[model samples]
Target: MTATMMTPAQLARFEARLLAERADAEERLAEFDGVMTEVRIARTDATADDEHDPEGPTMTQEWSQRSAVLADVRAELADVDRAIARIANGSYGVCTNCGKRITVARLDARPTAELCIDCARQAR
Candidate 1:
């Protein structure tokens, strides 16, 4: 394989890792959905009064925290999906910013990465 291209074995490994990440994110999102549903039902109770109860976090706070977690998981799933698409288009191991081959070590650590270490650090 050329320097810019990943070997077939490396491609397969990265693809599998990305797919697993996607699955985990999807599962977490589903769990969050179920918990959010329960929270919504609890909020509808006429005498619950969680806001003034002072036992723990209020229902609104729980809902907001869960929503933020759900959003992060959804973003992770999107990134994984994009990485998979890049694999299909023969650009999986190339950095989007510098157009260089992303190091195998970096990809092994973060299969959904879109930038090389240098470009990524520069962005930060």
Candidate 2:
């Protein structure tokens, strides 16, 4: 049998999911930005006295955590953007690596996924 294509309803549903995911990622990114800003401010405000205080978390440590979280949020936002583009280009539910139809269940679970389950697992 020929690989089934995504129906209009499926496309619409995935579109909605991608859009919602994008919004959530954007919000998280903004939140992280605010937090990173705070961390930078605190880091800059640190004085010679704070250097000797071992009880408080070091600004370097806080900055590291904030940077890591921000990177993850940005990556998620990029994935959402790519997925939306794929939707527009008529290839949203197609596996990029295997060129096969991704199952509806997987698409429903991760509209931003770029590969089939097998490829994804292998990638990991």
Candidate 3:
């Protein structure tokens, strides 16, 4: 499959984006952790009258949702880390499956992608 090569400028942009995303993911994970802590505290403080607590269930549901979100962010963070490693190894933008240079557009859209569009679509 044919692949588009990224210029050094494009690679730089991708690196910047990855770094920003990594920071964002870390922030989000921290927020989730804080929310989970609140949920735990609420559950622990619940007493007899508060047993039918509406806030408790809501907090639990929110915690569950945040957990799922945290998982996704963690996965993306791992991908970004791998992409940074590839850049350090001079293999940035190269498709893992076909050894073709991944397009700048694709990298801009997904800076952590390891495969080109064709291989990615086919793999799916």
* Index of the highest-TM-score prediction: 1
Tell me the tens digit of each residue's lDDT in model 1 across 1-124. 3245778998999888888888899999899989988887777662365446553457678778888998999999999999999999898889998789899999988888999999999999
Superposed Cα deviation of residue 84, candidate 3 (Å): 1.1
Work out how many backbone clashes candidate 3 has: 0
Give the alpha carbon lDDT tens digit for every residue of 60-122 in model 3: 787688778889988988998999888767788889999888877788778888998999999
lDDT of 2 by residue, 5-77 (tens): 8888879988998899999999998888888888776765675447665634766787788898889889899
Off by over 4 Å in 1: 1-4, 46-57
Select the stronger candidate by lDDT from 1 and 3. Answer: 1
- Compute each candidate's TM-score over C-alphas: 0.86, 0.86, 0.80
Candidate 1, residue 43: the lDDT equals 70
lDDT, residue 55, candidate 3: 76
Best by lDDT: 1
